[model samples]
Target: MKKAIGQILSGNMLSKALGLLREILMAKFFGTGDINGAYRIAQTGTLVPINFMTSDSLNSAFIPLYKKYLAEDEQRAAVFKYCMFLFFSVVSILIFSILYFQSEYWVKLMAPGISESAREMSVSLLKVMAVCCPFYLCSGLVNYISMAHGDYKPMSMRASAQNVGMVLGVVAAFYSGNYLYLAWGFTGSYVFFSFWVVFRAFKGEILNFPIRLETKEVKLVMSNFWITLRPLLILPLILQGNITLERALASLISIDVVSALDYARFITDTVVFILSVPIAFAGLSEWASQTPEQVREKIIKIYYWLALLVINMSFFIFLSARDIVIFLFMRGEFNEQSVMATTHIIQGMSIGLWAQVVGYIFIKALSAHLNNRKVLVVMVFSLLSNAIVNVLTYKIWGAFGLGIGNAIYGIVMFLVSAWYLKIARSLYPVIIQISAGIVIYFCVYRFIGGYFNESTSAMLRLLVNGMVFFLFAFLWAMLFPFYRQGVIKVMTRKRLR
Candidate 1:
């Protein structure tokens, strides 16, 4: 399990780096312009449905069932594999056709705040990018099949190929000044990746192309998949609706607002998603069928560490939001206005970043438990909180308010998870350490090395400021008896060795 986590973390780090690079290039080339806004809208429209299905309980149900069949009988596994492949292909094509035909209306509905030219451009881009659905879903199917075979490598690069695609798109748009290539490059990614994974799947013998699709196992597996999946159906709608609501509200303010919101969101989610994915994967077994009481202590430990990660990272990032934004994105087409806008959004997001992590983990655990009704109730309350806050605050704060709305949504979900899991009582011991860490970190950075904010090199300032806070925090922690003894024991062992 540790080895699996390490492998996943390594792949996630690479994919995240590539994903970050993709966003940086996009920001450099496009900034918060009309075309960038259009691209952002087009991406939102294209991906919401993809995530609705791909990231839903269907995929969650896929691998375990496949593993079950493979363990019991390889032929049965193959038959079920072909059956799912066929089913997903039909659904993908149907989705693509619908999006392709209705691109204009979708674009208009997605972002009414943008100009006519931008909207028209996005309609074109949406039509082109809609072709990605079939390839994307099929690629995921192959990737899941490979995963069930104990091959984690393919899933690691799941979105890496898409990031590479968008990187190419940014470069093409930069050189040719034709935004259409951006859409084509986006679509082209799924095309290339789908074929690549299919090849890998065949090579790995996880999937066989020339196979009998009809078998007795196919019917049984299909029925079981539905049975396993039926109750979780409302999940995708609520999750997708949260994203759609935020973007739509951002657009109501201005297209620039939505673009900044999108870019800033990518920055926050990169780290959050990377850390949380592993926790979710780890907790899957505990959640599968166990009662909450059975896993309370174990989960509390995990949650405590996650809390530490969230608090420390959030304070550091929130205070240093400007420097990070400048270092990463304040280049090329991304100028002063864009930086200011994006920094504000990042700061607001950092405030509740931990809530997103907690909420994400809670969602995964809940899904594994197969309680979709509870999931729906939790998610819908979150959505309502997000909508009310967004409508109330967006006009006043613009993109920052939208970011706050995101934070509220996350907080609602986390609150519900706390109630359902009933782990708040167990968290009391760590609360002091967490609070002390927050205070020390803020004072050390804000009063001392935070002066480095005026330094010319953004990177240097960030490093120095971060070191100053963490160093002080470590020393402060050593003053505590428990932490001091832990350090002393480690030193004593080192000397003995």
Candidate 2:
């Protein structure tokens, strides 16, 4: 189990490093604007179905069954191959039909605040993106096969390829100075990424596209798929509420508000991806292989370490919000107005980073336990609350309101997930540790902020204050015996050693 966890962590770290580089390049080139927003929306449309069908549902169902079949009979490899072929065929057809018929409606609905020119651009981008859906579906099949075969490195590299492709595409777009050509680059990347995965899976001998799909294998796959989808079917409604609210409220704002929100979110997501990926890759795969008792113990330890990590990260971002905006953005055409707009949004989002981290872990734990129904229920409530807040706030405060509403929603979700996890195991100690760390960090930051004169550079002050806060936090955690032990446990893991 430890070895498996190590493998996953190593792979995820590599993938995340490349992904971060891609984001830095994106920030440098595009900054925050209408073009980036259109790209995000178009990508979101392509991703939504792929997430539901493949990464989300297929992994939960296909993995255990594939392992079971392999353990029981070597000949069952044929069954697995046929099953993947059938799954891909059915999903590809469905995805193609939806994208073909509803691309215009979705584009208009998602960004109704944009101008006619932007809207047309968005629709065209969506059309190009639609072609990548089948590729993603196929890629998902290959990922499942690779994982089942215990060849996660290939799978990781395949995942990383998308980011590499995106980085190249963005450079191409920048050189050409054409948004339409940039959109094509984006589409081309996905197509290339899919082929890369397919090629790797073939090389690994983990995937074999059968000449014909067998009816028995089809039935077997369908049985597992239905079992998976039964719990996941409610996810779309429960999860998309916040996004739906964002689109609706952005439409009510000026033309650029949606684009602004999307760009700000891109920055927030970068932070999330960095912190969450390592914990998730290490924790989930480890927890999955543990016995109930061992799993419970591991969860408690991980929760403490994760809380500490998130607290530190949240403070760092919150204190350095302005500097980060200026440093990453504030380039050509990403003027003062854009910086101010994005800084406001990033500040609002910083408040929720802690909650987002906790919620991610809780959700992954639930999925591991096959308690998807419970998770679905929580997501539904969170989505509903997010919608109400987004609508009310947008009416009152415009674009900034959307950011505030999302922050509040994130807090609510974190509390709810914490409550659920607590019911499963006592979380009061973890909560106390996190609260203590935050209070101490903030106190130190305030002291440092007071001493800094008005004449000092904002970026310089931010850097100095952030270092002080982190130093204080580290000392504070070291002073607490329990937290010190937890830190040692995480840092001294065999993988790290």
Candidate 3:
């Protein structure tokens, strides 16, 4: 799991590094305007559903089954790979056609509250964005398939390629003054990636596609896929649908609301997802063969370690959100209002970042158990509560209410997954530790922040405050047995080397 995480982390780091650059370029070029809002919708609107079908929950279903099929019979596994690839390609291409032809209606469904002109822009962008659905679907398959085969490096580098596409679009749109390139550049990334991923998968000998297989062999693969995929299919519907609605909800306020909310999410979501996602992916692969009890125990241990780092991270983001926003995005059309808009949302969302780290693992644990039904039940509850919470609060807080809703959703997701897994009881101690850590970190941050004067630069204050706070957190965290041991082992290893 550690090795897998390292592989995932390295790729994610570069990818996210580029992602930051991409967001910076976007902020400078477009800011919180209708053009940016529509572009965001065009990109997010198309990709969200595509992600639902092909990413997260789908990968959970695919990787374990791929491993099982390969172990039991390599030939059958290859057949399954080809079968799934063919199946998704056909399905996704059909989806692309429908979305391409119906982008006008599609944009309306995605963000009904946008102005008529924004809607028109979204339609145009969605048409171009629609072209990448099949590529994303197919590329996701090869990436996961490659991961199953112990090839993680190419997968990590993939983000750079994809971001390179978006970055190009940003520069082109800035120089050429044609926003159409935004959609075009974004779509081109996935098209490039589909070819890149498949080639890597083939070169790694992960699977030899287009190989001869009997009708019976295809049936066997499909049968297993059906069994594996059916249980987890609705996950995307519940989870992804909730996200779409949330974005739509943002759109309802204003195009600027939609854009600001999108901007806010990019920062908060990256912080959470980048940290948790690799661990979840790697943990799923490891826990796939473990018993329920063993998996539960590992969940507790992972939570124990991961919670501290993430909680500190969340609080840091919360404390310095305004500064961070200003540092990252306070230029060009992104002005003080943009800073305030995104800063509030980032702070609101930070309240729940720690929850997602654990929640992701819990979901993966359930998926590893093939207990997708339970996963569905928890998500449904979380979605309902998330909706109700957002409804009641959006009036008060505007789109930033959605950020609070996000925190609630993640906390609910984590708690519910824990309850369903029968590990809720064991997690009590871990939760208490995390709570205490947050309280202490906040107090310390407040104390330390008092020393930094208004004369300091936002970036400089953020840097100094963060480093000092973490140094204190590190010293305080050493009082705990687990953390102390972890630190000692690290120091010992360094001395030996």
- Per lDDT, the best of the predicted structures is 3
- Writing each residue's lDDT as its tens digit, candidate 1 over 1-497 gives 45545656777788788888988998888888889988989988998888777864665677656666777877778788888888888888888987899889888777877889988888988988998999989988887777566666677786677888888888998899899989988899889989988888778776764355555657787888787776667767877777787778877887777778877888888877688876675455335546766556566757766776676777778888889989998898888888888888888888778877877777667666665566667777887888888889888998788878878887888778666767766655565686687886676555764564364699988887788766766676676675678679889999999
Each candidate: RMSD: 3.0, 3.5, 2.1
TM-score of each: 0.90, 0.86, 0.94
- List the candidates ranked by lDDT, beginning with the highest: 3, 1, 2
Candidate with better TM-score, 2 vs 3:
3
lDDT of 3: 0.82
After superposition, candidate 3 runs with Cα above 4 Å error: 209-212, 440-449, 453-455
- Please list the C-alpha lDDT of all candidates, in the order they appear: 0.77, 0.67, 0.82
lDDT of 2: 0.67
Q: Considering every candidate listed, which one attains the maximal TM-score?
A: 3
Model 2 alpha-carbon drift over 4 Å, by segment:
1-31, 55-57, 73-81, 208-217, 281-286, 408-425, 440-444, 447-459, 486-497
Report lDDT (Cα) of residue 141, candidate 1.
83
Candidate 1 residue 249 C-alpha distance from true site, Å: 1.3
